[model samples]
Target: MTNHAAGSIPDAANTLVSENGYYGAYGGSFIPEILVPAFAEISRHFEEIRHDGDFWQRYCALLANYSGRPTPLTYADRLTAHFDRAKIYIKREDLNHTGAHKLNNALGQALLAKRMGKTRIIAETGAGQHGVATATVAAKLGLSATIYMGREDMERQYANVFWMKRLGAEVVGVDYGSQTLKDAINETLRDWVSSFETTHYVLGTASGAHPFPAIVAFFQSIIGVETKDQILQAAGRLPDRVYACVGGGSNALGVFQAFFPHDEVGLVGVEAGGQGRDSSNHAARIAYGEGKPGVAQGYRTMFLQNSDGQMKDTYSIAAGLDYVGVSPILADLSEKGRVRFAAATDAEVVEALQLVMKTEGLIPALESTHAFAGAFQDIAESSKSDIFIINMSGRGDKDIFNIAEGLQDEEWKGFIKRKNSQFEDQSR
Candidate 1:
């Protein structure tokens, strides 16, 4: 590993990508042969644009004009009393144009695609939010767009599917493997390998190879910048706790960026607990196992893989938060104990969703619910002298129908039948 001064992350950060394109042994492209040139080109061009004022000027202009940036930092009034320890605040990235923090990075990469003179964009999406965001930008930029989604998710996230279609993008549903994010990524990679000459692959998270992880983080760091300023403006001081949900970990990393240098801010990442960590079903990677370096989904990172190196089955009620491996940088941070990681059960996420909608009049995406669940813990444990902030990563409109549908699954049939039988006998 190349050495740099501790805490002095390179100002021109992309230049610091190591020989293997690592951010301290957490990132690298371990892809097939066909993707080398494309990834290398992305890395090289990304480095060139590291400090390009003109590029940023245009980017900033778009954010102002189109995306409504400098998203609000809102206080969660009802949660404050219940948590009792700290004032709870939120960085309302959920209110972004595309409804999640994914757009911040997607738009940034889409801008880069324009700079690269690419005419088409391809992306792999889970929960379909990233695909929708990518397709939205590609439409706005008048570029051709294609999004690959897991076949199962295509059904579960039908609203996002409709959004991508409305934005004039072709959605290819992949049925391979587990029919999930990993499979969608495999399909997108196949397309990238074949069409790299003219297509830009817009990865949605900060977990890919070297340049991608760095680039996505840089773009999404707007969350941190805005949050820091907004929190100070609203609360007159820094928040004591900050929370964000982790999938491939972009949103968490984005929000965590501004606070990394602050020892006082307690950074927490809420991983998906499909059932529970101890149960067979869970997406709780960090809590369940030691995160060793391994390759999956084109980047080498910390994943819950079996002894044979195959990835383990991941489970989460939130499709967007169901990835088996987390971003390598997050793994590093957790390993160093710089950040605290926690798990939130699906039941807890649903409860948090209900609480936010009823009290805050906002419906948060299920993926983001993990943050609220964890922040609730911080709020509950605190003594009302502290402040907690949760990154409300997206609106929950897309998840409402799916979440409701899941509640009516075959598993509930027995309960339904017993309740109906009791009611019928009572009437007789």
Candidate 2:
């Protein structure tokens, strides 16, 4: 593949994977024969439309008018003062219409599905942000929508589940395997295998099969694109480092890809370190786990696997970060030392969340809090003149229940119980 430097627009032939979809031995299509046609169709249309100016015009217009574009790049003055090292800025993706960066990809893919004449949309979500985003777009477009979520995630993120249902989506809870994001992905793929004719599967992150990683990254690149421009305007130069939390790596790849060709800009991806890396509770596949390449979820990448090559279960206080495998593009980049990987434990993430709220007056999602924690660690030894930008991938509204529980907010729990009792009484 052709290599494009930073500050240039990346075309399919340059920035993305090869024609066969291998990103330096990491990414490829490894699906069954039955799914070949669907993947090929998506690949063909995406290749055609991605280069079309009209397609981008429409996509950008929708982003600006409907979903909110050019999200703010706010200077966290208090955070910088607290750190007393790096001057910190945050790309406020949390302020988007659906409260996260997921809507960017969701809206783009939904528009593509419309172009393809697909009438239904299916997606799998962990923290339910993607599901809510997908459902919101489907409702706006007057298309039928179905969301597959793990049973455990549905319970933990019940507020998002409620919003998705209210938006007119059929929510299916997968109970197989660990009954989490991985299982939800497996179920969504099975559904796509049979329904690929009239349905479009909106894969949540920058993982999965060939076109998906590329496609999702293409949509998400808007984040990095905006950040680069905004940071230049705000700080008069590129940041010394950019940090983002990586689950399936959509947000990280979104921000990192724009800075990939910039060797001076440090790219740091923070993974979920659960309880700790010493224990098996972390999802730091590229950081602490076996970095062996293997095929799972229709792509080859580094995964948390056991001796028998079975994918191991992962844990994180943030449901979105609890994944066994990461984005293949990120894996390849990490291996090549183009990007750095770090992990923040659950405790550190919670502390970071509180710190951001107290200092910046921004309630960041738990997933984004990992990036905050990682940035704190990295900036501690750096000079005060150093500049860092954190991609605040989502707001903390969806995570209020989880955060309250994590921080042991008994008053919040009592309020929730009171509300639940009121609803129960109304139902009775």
Candidate 3:
């Protein structure tokens, strides 16, 4: 709320968070009483630095000099021709440092941690992009860092795990309870409960408890701010619709935040459909009513759960989208109809990724392919004059293993085996 997302939001969100961080009945800090004071301290420090002009200047400087800012806005002519309807534009957040938009929030939180005099940092990652971002920042800041990732995601995104360790971070693989984003989150929170005095938990995405969602969104709003300016300059007007893949909803919220004030622009969030919707395995929390209103991971939101309140296992070809719940900010948006939600099944996402790589020569992360596949669902109904801006949240460099498997490339799998054998021989 904090005036950053002050305009055109719901009446409840128009003011600073009232009722102890509830965003219109969707958000609140539900945590151990032992960690209450720790969270309060984070809230206090965040409020102070957000208002400090000097802090803003320092953060912006780091973004420009170290992380790179003002990522490109490009027209996808080949994609437009193939679709033969709306003109396709891309907000190239994929080009940022660490090859993803996650760096924006990582740098912001790392600086805040420094200002608070915390030395050690902990994080949970699914796709591995956030883990890499956190490790990179920690190395540059000379702080200790530990990253918790799901065992399944570690295999799927092995490249990211390698980079995180090379950047001097301890990567812990969580093996129980679905072995994905949710389990990693649980582990990170458990670590934070005991180490809150010396460690800062850099909640990767725009979800979780009270101040975290707000804090992550504030850092990520740079995407929306830049896109608004770039689209106006390039297209001579605002886009008809903005599309972004929604996992934990950080990238989607980052791209949708500025456009909230401009009611003319439509906001679309596409969730991962691991299989067909009928299969009961996908992560389409919004489009499908599978995730009912509930609390998990320290906040209340719509989560995929059974009647007994036990969490349901969710699946996605993209490791990042394998979470059980959507962000509280997004949950509120869905109820109010401010954002339209959709799901792109695993098959559809793979097809979309292949098509874009062929047509536009961009290898977008599997997580982002959900948005492209979702938008393509509208091509037959739209006019050619309409403009659509899709946020490519990250590149596919760190997703080589997942992408190869998604395409069912047997040769690449064989190559991986051969390479592993060669490395084993050398190490021996």
The TM-score leader among the candidates is 2
Off by over 4 Å in 2: 1-16, 420-428
Clashing pairs in 3: none
lDDT tens digits, residues 13-74, model 1? 34335777776667777777877888888887887766676776677667767888878888
* Candidate numbers, best TM-score first, in rank order: 2, 3, 1
Off by over 4 Å in 3: 1-16, 423-428
Per-residue CA lDDT of candidate 3, range 197-297, in tens?
Answer: 98999999989999898888888887887788788888899999999999999999889987887788999999988887899889988888788999888
Give the whole-model CA lDDT for all candidates, comma-separated.
0.81, 0.89, 0.88
How well is each residue in 166-214 modelled by candidate 2, as lDDT tens digits? 9999999999787899999999999999999999999999899998998
RMSD list, candidates in order: 6.8, 3.3, 3.4
**Model 2 TM:** 0.96
Q: Candidate 3: RMSD over Cα atoms?
A: 3.4
